[model samples]
Target chain A: MKQEFNITVFSENHIGLLARITIVFTRRKINIESLTVSESAISGVYKFTIVIKTTEDQVKKVVSQIEKIVDVLKAFYHTNQELIYQEIALYKVPTDALYDSDQIENIVRNSGARILEITREFTVIEKTGHKEETQALFEQLNQFKVMQFIRSGRVALTRDPIERLSEFLKERDAFLNSMD
Target chain B: MNKEPMKVTGSEAVILSLLEEGVEIIFGYPGGAIMPIYDALYDYDKKITHILTRHEQGAAHAAEGYAKITGKAGVCFATSGPGATNLITGIADAMIDSIPMVCITGQVASPLLGTDAFQESDVLGISMPVTKWNYQITTPEEIPDAIAQAFFIAQSGRPGPVLLDITKDAQFGELEFSYKKCKKIRSYVPETPVDPFKVKAAAELIDNAKKPMLLFGQGVIISKAEEELKAFIEKTGIPAAWTLLGLSALPTEHPLNVGMLGMHGNYGPNVKTNEADLIIAVGMRFDDRVTGKVSAYARDAKIVHLDIDHAEINKIIKADVAVLGDAKKSLKMLTDNCKKNEHKKWLSEFNKAYDTEFEKVIDKDLHPTKEGLTMGEVISKVSEATNHEAILVTDVGQHQMVAARYFKFKHSRSLVTSGGLGTMGYGLPASMGAQLAAPDRTVVAVIGDGGFQMTIQELGTIAQNKLPVKIVLLNNNFLGMVRQWQQLFFEKRYSFTELINPDFLMITKGFGINGQKVTSRENLDAAVKEMMDHDGPYLLEVVVEKEDNVFPMVPSGASVSHILLEP
Candidate 1:
């Protein structure tokens, strides 16, 4: 089935290298939902996470092509079901409605929200949860006047228990030594 | 045997001349080709503080921040090709904001210039549109004069970015270095004042019109004529509205100052701009955001444009009387010649509209019992705590609008945000640069959680330098601006508007910077005070209402007259 897949790649940083990665998806007609760059544990390395909707074969080919890039060291592909991810949404509703109804409060508690501020006319709220849960909350809250909204691209780590970078690096070095 | 004067490269002459100009700081990095200039830098007196940035882009931004805060030409240097190209965004950022800065880049040797030499890029050609002036120095003798002229152009007129590209060979070759006082520049003649006849015509229009509105732009602030603008508006009792770049030109609390007048502007400002019979626009280009669907904007109004740049006059919107001159000089002349008329009825209507709209968004009693804080409340508390005096720099997003809407900046260049470029990751780096320039002044980077994370790598730069810049992370956990679009235009399909962030507190703590999370308004004051009290760099992760939106929005593709205040 065609589904959305968020692929997070860990690699070294190079100039204009993201363009190369995105071009692969673009040429394949894969629409990227969101993309972000961050630093990784190893010095001089960067992590890129991109959300795209495509089939398994297409993702595999894309990952293989990405791995072939000079600076890309590792590519991790995670389907929506396999990985746990959270997103944030910000909304600005009318301030006058704050005291009139508890509707806003009910929405907050159900969404696992934390109230960030209170002013005379408006309130600012923050919520973090799974993508579906966050979207559900936005849908529920959209009836109120909205001023602006934005999301940080998803950042993820493996949920399963695994050795960290230090141990992984050591093991990889030992394997290379054995091969030598 | 006869002795002669010692010789030095053109690049060396430029450096020596810059030092003579009393430039105490040069933010840059070293690379191939420009090694000669770096060599010369060692022989000079240690008055100039050379900061080695991780990237050339950072150098340019730092220079921009320095210039913004100090009101002087900030200098940055880069080597050819990639380095020059990297500086392009920062150059463009400064250009859009009308900042005074001079960027010097090393080009590949003149002979190998067009041969696609290893690091050679046609930087001057690429930077022409984004710079006030740009030149590639081919000869050794032109270095001193070019350097002098670059500073002059950058600091004078409307104040924009300038670039000087010198060939690598020029840096290696030797020449006698001398400084000559600049008599005058012929090609670059900035407007002095508007024609007195045109000023009289503008005054007559203002006097005769029943509904007169003033549209101010960044030119007023750059010209240091805020007082003159206030006088003109106050004397005429004319209502005024601001553009994004015009935010610093008028005080937020001024009786006639109707905040920003554009797509995301205050309702009253946009309404008045639409309803006015006469509009006196000064120092601002009618940016598309300000005049959405231009055919409908101020269609019935008589438009008078006063700008220092002749090219900007009638560039986008036609002007009834185009007065090409310094904004200050032109406004002063207009005020001097015009008779004072109090538009009491018009002012009352504008005031009523302002209050009605202000009450909706700026009510202090409204409490967000919801999951997140509202963007309005975040800005309200930020301005309240800082008294709106801190150097408030913001990355592009919903947060930029919130700050512009709420923050009351009293000084010129007080509020710095990406206006024309709207670049993300601009806030943190630009704030870092600002704090470096104004070390003692309180500087804050107000960025959305999404925008904050974009350039958070700059935290390393902040931590490394120990610069005390307060960062307010409005953590809504969503790409708040895009989500607004998804809600309004995309029908809440919400394809991917989420961000799961690492615990910001832990993240800040790992960097050894002070970090605090304010979950409620009760905690906000304390957290801000604690962060301010702790000293060094501080990150205040303000978890605001996720669903909160900026109000009085002119719906996308709509005219300034059509605004959506609420659902």
Candidate 2:
């Protein structure tokens, strides 16, 4: 069955590593739904969170290939049930609309969103939730006319208590030490 | 740790780094961007030998050939822009075939990068997908470590090509240079630890099978585990077959060796692959060509795949038991765990199939009574004359298949051809590197008319070096492989597959190399003998039948068992 998969990759922070990781997806014609990169908890190591709608088999192969990159320390894939993920979206609306209706404030409250700032020209509202939830908030605000909207790529963490990369590194270090 | 770094120009540091890596020969073409490196090279004539190829592509292929023959990472040099772009094909070719090569291309000055300066190109971006690893050095201090990493990565694990793009400024700048060979990288693990449990499981599966088949490829040669493989085959007495890249890993006459496997491979291997109870694949990925239709390929068999690359496992044909590690260690472990079993009944079945193929196809191809010369007979003749010991480097085409099928190899690493990429012009330049690497051995390049013209300019390199490379040109006046496909599948449209005229002998003479042309069967033997007897490089063009087809073929999208003996 085809469903959403969250692929997590840990690597050394190197130039062009993002392109290298993305090309693996491009070659296989797999469209990435969302991608996020940031420093991991470990010093000097980077983390990549990529979301794609693909079969389990395809995702397995993709993760294997991603791990094949020289700089990639390790890669793993998980289902929605296995990960805690969210996307932050921002909405800009005309400030006149906010004053014209109390419904806009009600809609914002119901969507669990907060207004960041308000100027005479526009009002900026920020929301952090699942993609569908953010889209729902945008639709409700679209009634009063949303001037602009933007959403960040998915940021996710596995439900597992320990960081998989650290475990992998420890095992690898042990092996290397044994070799010595 | 106590050694002090000596101040030297980056170009000199580059040369020193290569020397530290024990690189003795470099194939390259000089240009403005790389002039500094070449200038530094001028003073080190006694320390390092550089061969100036006519084109950057030829240099890369020569490096590939050198690497294949010497079992070391071959080094190549080229300038930026077009020079770097030209090496792309060879780099891609080496990448696909897992040939270890370190290609150093010169870029414009650091400030001129991305400004579209003269001879400036995004070599790192262009070569990213193809190279095993690539880095750009804008500072002189980064040269040594970058070059060291490039060589280490290129030759480690599943070997592939690596590119290092150094800016002109870096080459001109001076730095305190001290070489430290890279012993390890925190992120990369070149060797996968072999699991004893998996090896035991694989051995159990192998011992339990009634009909077991061993399929090997270049991994045997790359791992230098030919003896281990032989022991494994001998202990189990399994009917072993080889992929094209795996051709010379085992001697052709090895009794347990069945034959080649794939589209135009031997009948026994193709048919019996479907009938086998277990398939032991070592260091060879199940390429589409080898596995006809994957859904039906070895459907009844349990596969045990042993490879260094984990990505290759379950990529095509899924293995029931996956043994991850170098084939050398894994094979030895499996052999130790495996029991002695002579599957005499299974052995007879392969022989029966071979006899049928020999009577039906091999006889006619090897000893044809037809009016024109067959590619098979010419290859057979060459094999017989060379005593099956010469290193055969072939270009891609019908000629490649013919050479792979008909040529006999008595030693490992005797065949160097572009197997995965099927690069057309690989033969000529590769032969030069092969000869230089193994100067005592005869390096014969078997090239088709279509492929020969692709890299014909390489004749200048052979002429300049006076490298004793025997060239055999099989001129059929057509791209025989595609023409055969057209005849069988496309209703004989021809479609620009036919070539006009080229006086090959004249071209060779113009390049100052010995040449001959034989159009008749009566003159074939003498022409070959004369070409082989010549002092240096020789081109012997043999005009064969225009429309000859390679048979025992598995048609596109068909099962391996559905292979046909004739068109």
Candidate 3:
């Protein structure tokens, strides 16, 4: 069964790392739904949050393969239930649509979106939610005369009761110390 | 770290680091981007020798051949841009086959990076997918550690090629260099520790198995665990079959050794894979060629996979018991735990299939009555001339399958050819590395006329080096393998598989190499002998029947047991 898996990879801030990681997916013909890279809690290391729809077997294999890369410290995959995730999207609509005021205001308020800026030419709205939810806001705004819109790739945090990176570091330190 | 309190150029550091790693010779070509390193190399003439290959691709393949033959990491160098891109194929070849190679390509000056300067390309970007790990050195200081890391990564853990793209400025810059041999990486685990529990479980399965068989690959040789595998098999008295890379690990004539596996493999091994009660796969990826119709492969068997790479486990065939570790250690543990026993019934089944294949396929091919000189007879003749001891480096096609099926191995690492990638032009250049690494060994490169033409320019490297490598050309005027498939499945439509012609003997002579062409079966044996007897490189072209096809093939997508002996 194909289920959406959110895979988080932690690695060094190395050059060509993104292209390298994506090749693994491209090799397997697995489509990435969303991807975002950002600085992690660890100093000098970065995190890659990637979303893909695949079987549990495939996702496990992909994670293992990704971790095989030299710079990658670790990689893990989780179901949607295991991650607290959100996608942020911004919509730009002509100010003329906001001129009506009542309908646009009601839609914005009902959809839990924020008005980032309003100008004589256009109004910009922001929404932070699940991909489908943010996409719903774009759809509602699309009914109006929307100028342009864009959605940021997914950002995620695992809903882990135990801290993984700390434990991993502790284990790493013990292993290294033993070598001396 | 080196205790010398002196400064050195980055190019000198590169040479020093390679020397520290015990690299004696490198296969490479000098160009604009790498001239600094070549300059340093010019002074260190006593320390290291570099063979200037005609093409970067040839250098890369030669390095792979060297590594494969010597069981050491092969080194090669090239300038960036076209030189680096030229290496991409060989890099991919090494990656897929688990050949250990350290490739250093010189890049444009650091400032010129990403600016589309002359001979500048994103080599780090290009080589990443093909290499086990790759790094760029923009400054002289980083060269030592990066190179140390590159060597470490290339030779350790499921070995493959690693690339270091050093900028020209870095090579020219001066730095107070100190060399630290990287013994360990914090994140990299060279050896995946063998699980005692899994080893115990695996031994129990081997003990309980009634019709157990040991299937081993090049991993046994890679881990230098040949003795461990032999002990395990001898103690267990199990029938063993080999993957292409695994050919020379165990003596082919060993009593319990079965035969090859995959397409164009023997009939018995393929049939018995389904019959065996336990399938113990060690050090081989279950590639599609090996596991034809995986659904039917070893269906009745409880599969036990012992491999160093964890990712390989259950990637294709699901293992009921997975013993993950270095082959030497894991096989040792398993050997210590296994009991002495024999699967006589299983052994007999393999022999039965072998006898049938020998009669139907082996006999006629090796001893032919057809007017034209057959490829099989030629390889068989070469095997005889070399006393089955020569390193048989073969290019891809019907000749490759024929060589694997017919040419025997008398020692470990006797066969050096592209197995996983099946790269066509691998044989001729690879022989250069194999011969350079083991100058005492007689290297015979058996290539098809078609594949030989692909990288035929490598003749320059061989002649320039004055290396003695016997080149056997099976001249059939078509790409035999694809033509066979077309003939069988596509109704005898040869298509564009036919080649016009080439006076190979003249071409080889032009390169100042001894050469001959044998048309009759009577002259075949003497021609092979002459090629082997030559003091330097020799090319012997034996014109064979054009439409001849290799059989005992499991048609694509079919079960291995359902092998077609003849079309």
Best by TM-score: 2
lDDT of 1 by residue, B1-567 (tens): 122434777767877789767787887878886778877887774666777776787788778878877778888889888989988998999987888899989888899978999998888777765776677887787788888888877887778898989888877777877776443443234444469999998989998989999999888878888999999999999988888878877777777886788878878778777788999998889888888778788977999999887556666787899888888788999999888888989888877877877676556313455545676776767777777778888888888888888877766677777888887778887887788778878898898888777667677777888878888888888888888888888988776888888888887788788888888777777887787777799998888877667777888678888877764
lDDT, candidate 2, B382-473, per-residue tens: 88889999999999999999999999989999999999999999999999889889999999999999999999999999999999999999
Q: Is the docking of candidate 3 incorrect, acceptable, medium or high quality?
A: medium
Alpha-carbon error at A119 in model 2, in Å?
1.2
User: Highest DockQ, which number?
Assistant: 2
Query: Could you tell which candidate, 1 or 3, scores higher by TM-score?
Result: 3
Residue pairs in candidate 3 whose N, alpha carbon or C atoms collide under 3 angstroms: none
| Per-residue error (Å), model 3, residue B308 | 1.1
TM-score of chain B of 1: 0.94
Query: Per-residue lDDT for A1-180 in model 1, tens only?
Result: 678887877665644467667766766788898787888767776888898988876676677556534345567688877777777766666766667799988888877887787787777777777667767777777778655555667876667676244454565455445533
Model 3, clash count? 0
Spell out the clash pairs found in candidate 2: none
- Candidate-wise lDDT, in order: 0.78, 0.93, 0.90
Better of 2 and 3 by TM-score: 2
Candidate 3, superposed: residue stretches over 4 Å from native: A93-108, A117-123, A176-180
Local accuracy of candidate 3 as per-residue lDDT tens digits, B174-291: 9887888887777677666799999999999999999998889999889988888888999998999999888888877888889899898888888888888999999998888988
Task: Name the regions of candidate 2 deviating beyond 4 angstroms.
Answer: B1-3
Model 2 alpha-carbon miss at residue B41, Å: 0.7
